[model samples]
Target: MAKALIKYALTALLLCTGLAGAQAQESGSSAARKAVPKIQDGWLDVRAGEGQGRLPIHVSRDWSQAQPAVRRALIVVHGITRDDLLAGERAAAKVPSAADDAIIITPQFLIAEDVAAHQLPELTLRWGVDDWKAGFKAQAPAPLSAYAVMDAIFARLLDRQLFPNLQSIVLAGHSAGGQYLQRYALFGQGSALVDQAGVRLRYVVANPSSYAYANDLRPLAAGGFAAADASQCERVDRWPYSLSANLPAYARKPLDPAALMRRYLAHDVIYLLGEEDKDPHHPQLDKSCAGEAQGDSRLQRGRYYFAYAAQFPRDAAFKQRLFIVPGVAHNSTRMFGSSCGLAALFDEGRCTTEVAAP
Candidate 1:
């Protein structure tokens, strides 16, 4: 009988140990949700995904307290520089008067070396090359795509507990950041998740180098749009340009021109262009054959794209506008902070096509 008791005691102890370890792992996973530095004014505690996880989005110090008072979530994405923390800070400071209780978030997509160089905390996700820009899988140890990061963020924000009363979610980006949103708006699989969240969603694309066209039609140099000379540039309708073929992995499915067009038109989108950003041969300007197929200059392309979408007959409910911010060049700071920027964001600032050039 003593021998039997000893064996039973040993078995109980092993079971307890196993349970304790499982509980600890569960706690650790929960604790790993976010890591916030001691600093203020940026970097929130909203985190998702796994393995070398991405940075927690930046936010105002009072974000928690402000959640209850918030009505809008202004998600400002960074450009090719991947300096979203800084971008978020600057963009948040430019809030329109109408967005009295809006919350601003900036998702920081980093490079592997950037963390070590800047001494950032460990487990900070970083993409190799420009993979993140295309919503490609993140660097090894974490297979999360850039688009998935945004998806997780939207889900978290829509949580009844985190933000109980959000009325609008604005996904806005400039330059490379603009390119990300433009594609995500068309191909992000999370659109259904966002749509069901019962909040109004907005997409503001500011001064992107190019756009994803629904058809193979390319804008002409002399006048209207037309099909590209297939023999000359057969790859004209490729990914990131015209949804022709070879879509990136993050592209949820094959680009269905008609479906994409309907989805894009149904969403609330605004193309905010910088009027003075008209340098046809600007060094940073996309000189790629695809870009040239759009227009000669950023200003021209924005105007042309807007016209194209406006003329699309499939979706009669297409309600998109292209607003040119006066006197602003290729600067997001001035572009977003201008009175015109305020209007695009909060629906209450002065913006008109007719303005004296700055």
Candidate 2:
């Protein structure tokens, strides 16, 4: 009876310890979630038709006056954390050239909890936790697409009075931000604004979870492309995955596939893939059927997408380059701070342009 009692008491103590540890972990996570900032440093006025809203952004310099020395602009987008300030600053610091030659702007997309936590004004735009990453319409104030915020910023940048010497614009993002830019590059009207202003535009997509396919074709495990089995996942060809009719209001009408493909190919896009980011079961990696249809890992998805784009007939202006960053994972700072990242931004460093043989 004494031995039985001792065993039972020891088991009870172990269970109690486990339960306490779980509760402590849960409490710590809740505290960390609550610690995220409610807003950014500056406000960007975005007005589309009758819908007017304010976006929180971090501008490296005061745009009110003319920045004649500014020859390049770097618009860096943050990942899921919405920490734009740190992202923008870190990217700018990676450039080894003249510091004042470029202006950096980073925009933050807030959520309902953020507005509620800080009691922000109603006109301050907000979206669902991860919806903004896909150009979803904002929840409060006016129904505005998050891409429209980028449009407004682009329009402001086109002003010669503010940035008279601005020659090129490097729109870059990492992870979720890369996903946003990859989709926005196809549908967003901001690129047209840059073209009209006669400013060179470049997009640097780094380590996104997935890519937007122009067709039903997906990468095969062995080596080639094949149409996805719709019987397995019905929504394989949906928006944000492939070009479909079910697009956000920002995209407006359904685009012609051929034209869209041609336009995207003609645009200069630099893809950066991390060599060490090959974990198939990464917690933050997109595990949906659509994502898996692309590849098993971020690195594979990037390689597959680059090869897929090569199959298309690009115009004379085609300028797409892909670089594999050695010894890096799904880290924003390390990926963007590498030689390839600096070359993609400042056109100075020597980045490896070709992938190694398997």
Q: Which of the numbered candidates is closest to the native, going by highest TM-score?
A: 2
TM-score of 2: 0.87
Q: How many residue pairs clash (N, CA or C atoms closer than 3 angstroms) in each of the candidate models, in the order given?
A: 3, 0
User: Could you give candidate 1's per-residue lDDT for residues 1-358 as a string of tens digits?
Assistant: 5445443333322322323222221112222223322222244232434433646466643554436767877888876655433544455566644346777777777666566666666555667545666677777446777887788778767877767778888888887788888888887867777789889888888888778888876655444556654344444567667777767776656457877877788888888899898987665565555566677678888877877777665555667777788888888777777777767776655677622211
Supply the TM-score for candidate 1.
0.79
Provide the TM-score for each candidate, comma-separated: 0.79, 0.87
**Lowest-scoring 10 consecutive residues by lDDT in candidate 1?**
24-33
Off by over 4 Å in 1: 1-52, 61-66, 84-100, 119-122, 354-358
Q: Give the worst 10-residue stretch by lDDT in candidate 2.
A: 20-29
What C-alpha lDDT does candidate 2 achieve relative to the native structure? 0.77
lDDT of 2 by residue, 1-358 (tens): 5455443333322322323222321112233234246477799998986498888888888997889989988888877666534655675676656486988888988877778887888888988655687888999788889899889989888899999999999889888889889888987888998998899999999999888888887766556666665445544677778885467878857578667877888788999899999997776676666666677789999999988888776666446888889999988888877888888877866796555322
lDDT of 1: 0.66
Model 2 / residue 180 / CA error / Å: 0.5
How many pairs of residues collide in model 2? 0
